[model samples]
Target: MPSNRKYPSLELDVSADHRPRIRLLLREGIIAVQLLVIASWLAVHLVLDERIATLGAWGPLLMMVALFTIQTRTNSDNVWRYSGLLFMLTVVLGFKLIFLEYPLLHRQFSLAMTVLAVVGASLLIRGPMDYLLVAVLSWVLVMPHIGHDDVSDYRWYLAIFFAFSISLGWINSRTYLRALSITLQIEQHYRTLSETDYLTSLYNRRALMDRFERFIESHGGGFFMMIDIDDFKRINDQLGHAAGDQVLRVLAARLRNMAGSHCAGRLGGEEFGVIIDTLSPAIALAIAERLLEAVRNSREAPARFTFSAGLVPFSHDQALADILIHADRCLYKAKRAGKDRVHFGVGEHLS
Candidate 1:
């Protein structure tokens, strides 16, 4: 049985389309860090200081409530991310304000330093530049408490702590960059697999339909052409499937070259299609004739093979399915009028 368990790396996947997941991870880490900081402070306070008169003892709990409220109430990822960053700053500034009134809490600057480092690492997504900004904030958080009597020992501890924090922040940022690269590569690979025909390297049928829908919504008129190889079954039956595949590939290349910036795709099997925008009926017919000629002249095939094409000039209001059906009918007429010809509509044929 295949394992249903997705690895932890799956959580780190960050692409342009997956930014919400990245924001969610950061928000969750923020919540966890806030809760842990609050709980630890309360536990230590209960054990050491029975007096409730300490500098803003109730402040962290209030912030916790606020963070929880923000998390629950807001659906915007940008709000969550920036609010979490602001919360960290508010928490640090709150401690700063309290320590001014109560010098006894000056020692807690070490704790504030740790908090800034942790939150910065957990929430910053912009890599080392972000880490540099957080390092500056770390200095600002710890500077006011530096001249206290016990700060000599605290200074030594802080020096080591700052180094650790910078290293950890760097690692976290690097991890984000690596994860982003991997996500983009994965996204590109999947997009290619979904949109491209495997054998012919042309846009697949599904991608073609999607582009056609976009064209319809744009309200711009264009020419739509349907192409079918003249005798693909005979080629496969007599020569081989390989020879048939070569013919398809060569034909697809010719169509791609002819279509230029326009749309071209494999509809399925030996049938292909193209849409040319902002072109007149005569130019569209000329392109159709050129495509037919390219297939006929292809030297990569085991034998010369020709294609029948149906061309239909459509207006913005024309239904896509109806236009396609009409073009297909024209293609059918070209095949019946004799193979290797282009048909604009009924009674309009060119060899």
Candidate 2:
């Protein structure tokens, strides 16, 4: 039989400090305001003083406090932290319903007891309308239960307060969530821009270097190919720089179309470097040939332009700089070995 392995716990993963601060502040705000309407709570609790000892009565109380504590402990989504207000309302209402302590805290704990059910329903419901309906129904059912201290009146005041409070809370949470989502999306876009070339929308030189460093550290296998467009300056000399820019853009697009998504852009006058994620020397050479063919075939000028490439797949004992130097040396050899060709660590011409 194989022996089971036990992993030892080492470090605790914690969220950023601001996350906890936000949870704590929101929970404090909700608890502060909700506890203020003490008139009805005191009225109900007076009727059943000894019921506090029962699990039914104390369970909801303990759960509500515990929920608030958990909400403030971690703000990050990965931490299973509660959305403070919703959790507080949930545990409070759920415990009340399960314990049927409605007669005790009337509206404070009992009036909005359906909100507890709404929070609970949120867990079960798949869409917005389902939870919204639960909330509406809970509010509706609690309508008859809400009234003034006097029976002579229809208890319209309590109804007005309940409706106003739920409406305000719902709208506030909706607006807050919308703003939060938009902010997150904008932040993500900004992060992408930081790592990519603005003109080409390709991974910039910095990002490419970072990836190369990681690959080297991991002993990753691949081919790093250097490509240079033949007679790029001659195009600019004959036509204007605008034409040169157009050709460069066109070249970038063609390269992208050839390589698909696994390509990066370094700031080059007429050169581009690609670290192809291929383990096969033959496959890397095939791609180099394909790129050479595609670029030469793309745009025809008065002197028909073509590209020269140098591919380095592996050097088991070579340093990183040595690999680049040799690849570059081979690139110049291809250029000298007559312009339009591909070289893989030798003078052997690519057909």
Candidate 3:
């Protein structure tokens, strides 16, 4: 049985792209650190003449900053990524001094690094806790590889290898995780954009209607009001689209705030719809009046336009279509009575 019985929301994010990028970065960093440490170890004896290893060891650190900048962190997790980078740095330095072709090491040094790499790969998927788990797992993986002539013969070198492996694994895993996190966020944002209205930051008509049906089913019955602004076209004509945009935004805010737990949405253009879970006609009227006031306050016109709402109650007996028809007629009566009131119809409401 899986520990995670509940699944996470399938929100695709930049983290997917990030996982690959982080992995690549860690790989490059570890490889570079490996080369530099090797060169530094050789230089100590008769290995190399130049002190180039000093520059190389720090080169990966610089790349880390650049990679992170491109990764664009959303929070504190961004700053912590470098901690893992430093761990990889340790691994490389340790590998060069103890496990390499020469030097003084305990026999277990090289064995430790191999374990570090494998466990680090696993921890890379786990995110931040890279240090402890990756380090311990590396040691467990290393013990089996020790040989008589190995660096284990120099017990001190073996300890260096252990510490070094842990550092390298931590650093490598950090970059990998940062990238994964980013990709995940990106995927999620994309999915939201598909179902959401970008302008008002609300659910679009599609989402609203879908949920409206669910609300009706859940509560056994309810009311559905199809609301439209009486003269929204005039606003667009007189104030320009931008100002019209502000009006729609203000109107949407008012509706959402007033609707509370009821489902509300911009059906499209300057129109909105609402679904409320209640059976009493009095409860319905109160909701309708509040909704009207919300729209009224949002407008600045002395001769401000108002919406005409058509409310249809769903009884256990009526089909959704019949309820919509009755509500539409009541809405027509409200509009015919001068366009700023809520009207209800158990049957068709005559103007």
Candidate models: Cα lDDT each: 0.69, 0.56, 0.59
Could you tally the backbone clashes for each prediction? 0, 0, 43
Which 10-residue window in model 1 sums to the lowest lDDT? 1-10
Tens digits of per-residue lDDT for model 3, 166-252 = 666666656555555655555545655655666665668787767766666667677778777787788888877887777776766
lDDT score at residue 293, model 2, on the 0-100 scale: 81
Scored by lDDT, model 2 comes in at 0.56
Best by TM-score: 1
Winner by lDDT: 1
Model 3: weakest 10-residue lDDT segment is 1-10
Clashes of 3: 43
Question: Clashing residue pairs, candidate 2?
Answer: none
Q: Tens digit of lDDT per residue, candidate 2, span 77-175?
A: 443333333443444444445434455445445555544444433332222444465556556544434445545564666556556655554555555
lDDT of 1 at 290: 75
What are the per-residue Cα lDDT tens digits for candidate 1 across 1-351?
Answer: 011122224444445556655555456665676666566556745754643455466666577568656853577766665555555555555555555555666655555655455546444434455456656575576554555465557678667666676677777777766676567556656776778888887889988888888887785778888999998999999999999999898887787688532788899989998887755777777778877777777787788999988888777787778888888889898899998998886334223
Report the number of backbone clashes for model 1: 0
